[model samples]
Target: MDYQLIWVLLIAFAVFAYVTLDGFDLGIGILFPFEKKQENRGKMMNAIAPIWDGNETWLVLGGGGLYATFPEAYSLLMTAFYIPVIVMLLALVFRGVAFEFRFKSRDHTNHWDFAFAAGSIIAAAMQGAMLGAFIEGINIKDGHFIGGAFDWISPFSIFCASAVVVGYALLGAGWLIMKVDGPLQGKLRAIAKPAVIWMAANLAVVSLMTTYLNPAYGDRWFSTPNIYYLAPIPIVTVGLMFWLWHAVKRREKTVFGITLSVFFLSYLGFGITLFPHIVPPVISFRDAASPDNSLSFMLVGAVIFLPVILGYTAYAYYVFRGKIDDAGYH
Candidate 1:
């Protein structure tokens, strides 16, 4: 069996799951400062309180899976992204701290709120910059990352960071639209149109820059037969973006679902672009994968534990499956 390929798919699934699940909550934090009322901020926090910590489960799975299944790729990428990765981790840690302390404090709640929002924004931007740098390709020689510490910082990376910020804000707004009503909901919907516009604009710029910088990616998308097959991706993406805008304007509850689909398509495009390469533009998954024995051992654990994680996640959401009545955590 192609254990290498299987592990790659599994890792990708975990990463994408982390991105979509945690994205909205991080977005909630991103959108936190914009809502002036403490009650509204609590509502935003409450909307995600049940599942926010749990959503990070996928990040552990993805990161751990990569280290276990593709050690070489893990080490190289981690080394290349050490600075940003560390910053992202610290931001997440601070965000979690803020999440816990904000609701507990009465007099100093605003301080905690600032921590949460700042942490979220920093974490999301770092994540996007790391992604952009990865797409920009790593400097690998003799199976080592030969890149500078600040190689991850660039115009493209900064743009990607901005795009992710806006994108997450959109996701947070869509989520809030589903959870709240009255004036706050109206405000969320009000912001959705501009969010969609910015998201679409960002997507176009990223797409153009990605293809222009990488001939292989350009051929993959625009080559004769490939264009016919891949044409629907961008078309459907634009259609969904417009649909989300209209849905929000119409006060349709499908805003969040459509927003998720847009993110999924964007992720799919990314996966397609970097296919067969775990360490992009350099090492293939097969080359980076661990021995078959190790993979088989891990696969057994994955088969047993993966379902447990998914089952609990689904159950949590099911249990908390309605609009939050109060913003109180407990």
Candidate 2:
């Protein structure tokens, strides 16, 4: 197998894992304000406390993999995305502080809660903005970033950010439904149903914009042989949207699985939509890849370490599995 392709796919897989895992916690934070009862809010926090940090390890892995295996792509991408990425990190700092402080300072709990929610929003928005900007295409001059600092700021990016907020909310709702019971769960279902609708709408808008505003993605996604092969992606995605709504309305415990499936399918579709390109139209993976020896060295270490990370992640989730009755550290 081509070590380059292997590393590329592994990095992609790592990113998908990060989005799906951290996505729920971010969703929970976004949905924090909706659950008014203090006890219920605490329970929401507790449900994610044990494994939230572990969930973020995938981001580090993905970033480290990219920088190690594809330094050129990493350099160019960071050059284009440095500002939002920095802001996103700062937001995560606030989130981490709030996560620890909210438990210690009873009188200022609300303030910490606000910080956590705000941080989640900022991080999610920055991520979505980056995604939108990447999709739209980052400016490059002779293989270097030439885009202005504000290149990532746009109406479409804002819409993508909002969509991610709702999508994460739905994931949070599904998690709450599984891990909590009673009126809180029911209220979560109420929030989730609409979240699914809004998320679906926003996803449609992003898809259309990607297909129309950017002809390269459009050509790849809607072109002849490619269209035939990829048609099931959207068809299943549409079906899963309805499935998620119905499952949420019924308060199914397994809605989390369905919710994750939706994201997995979407991730797969996005990969297909942008196949061969690591950055976009101009920068194919081969173009952006590091030298063969660099890739080969990383591939060996990655092979040994990837499974260890997955095993650890699975173990953490297993240990933390169950209902959340009260808010507190697990």
Candidate 3:
């Protein structure tokens, strides 16, 4: 296999990891204000506190991998998405500070909680907007961005921004259901139903819009060979959605596992459909990839470092396993 193809797969995996892991924490933050009681909000925060920071490692790896193996795509994307990137960074900083400070300052608890929620919303929105803009393709002429900085704030981008918030909420709810018990778990179970419904609706809308905006996607989906193989992905996705709904309603312990499966399957569908095209019609994997030497060097480092990261992440989660108690941070 080609080194470029290998690097593409690695970067894709990294992106998926980032989205699946850190995504729920952002969702939890967004949902924090919706909880009726202070105790409920604290439960939500405690559920994610142990592993949230570790989850962000995948984002760093994804960005670094892109820079190392596909310098051109990194340069173009960074240039086109400068403003959103900055906003995301600021949001991250605010959220991180708020996460720590909220527990320390009893008097300022409300202030920090608000900051955390606001930061989470902004960060998730900016990420979704950037993704939508990338799918729409950057306006590049002579290898330079020709579009305005606000090019990412269009209708489609806004829809994606809102959709991602709901998506993350669903994930967060699932996580709470798994890690918490008693009243908080019951409340999360109730929340999961609506969150899942919203996510399904948003996914349907995004799919329809994508097909409408790019006839190629419709054609590809309706085509023979691809359709036969790809049909199971959506079919299974809908089935899992229904399964998740039923599990949430029944207050099943496996709801979170099912929810994670749903996300994984959906991501797999996306990866299959979007492979070999990083920025769609305008840019392809081969065109966007760095030189073979660069890819090889990155691959070597990734082989050594990836497992260490995964190992430590697994160990941390294992060590922190079990329900969060009122004993607080240790």
Specify the highest-lDDT model's number: 1
TM-score of every model? 0.98, 0.97, 0.95
Model 2 C-alpha lDDT per residue in residues 1-330, reported as the tens digit of each score: 598899899999999999999999998999988877778888888999889998999999999889988788899889889999999999988998999999899999999999999999889889988988887787887898887988888998888878777888888888889898889988988888878889889888888888876777788888899899989989999998888878887856778998899889878877877888887768888888888888888788888998999999999888888777764434
lDDT of 1 by residue, 1-330 (tens): 888888899999999999889999999999887789988888989989889999999999999999999999999999999999999999999999999999788889999999999999999999999989989899999998898999999999999999999988888888888888788888888778888999999999998899976798899899999899988999999999888878988664698899899999999999888887888897989999999999989999999999999999999988876776564433
**After superposition on all CA atoms, how large is the RMSD of candidate 3?**
1.7
Off by over 4 Å in 3: 328-330
Scored by TM-score, the top model is 1
lDDT: worst 10-residue window of model 3: 321-330
Q: Which residue ranges in model 2 land beyond 4 Å of their true spot?
A: 327-330
lDDT for model 1, please: 0.90
TM-score attained by model 3: 0.95
Q: Rate the local accuracy (lDDT) of all candidates.
A: 0.90, 0.86, 0.82
After superposition, the stretches of candidate 1 with alpha carbons farther than 4 Å from their true spots are 327-330
Task: Pick the winner on TM-score between candidates 1 and 3.
Answer: 1
Root-mean-square deviation of every model: 1.4, 1.4, 1.7
Q: Which of the predicted structures, 1 or 3, would earn the higher lDDT when compared with the native? A: 1
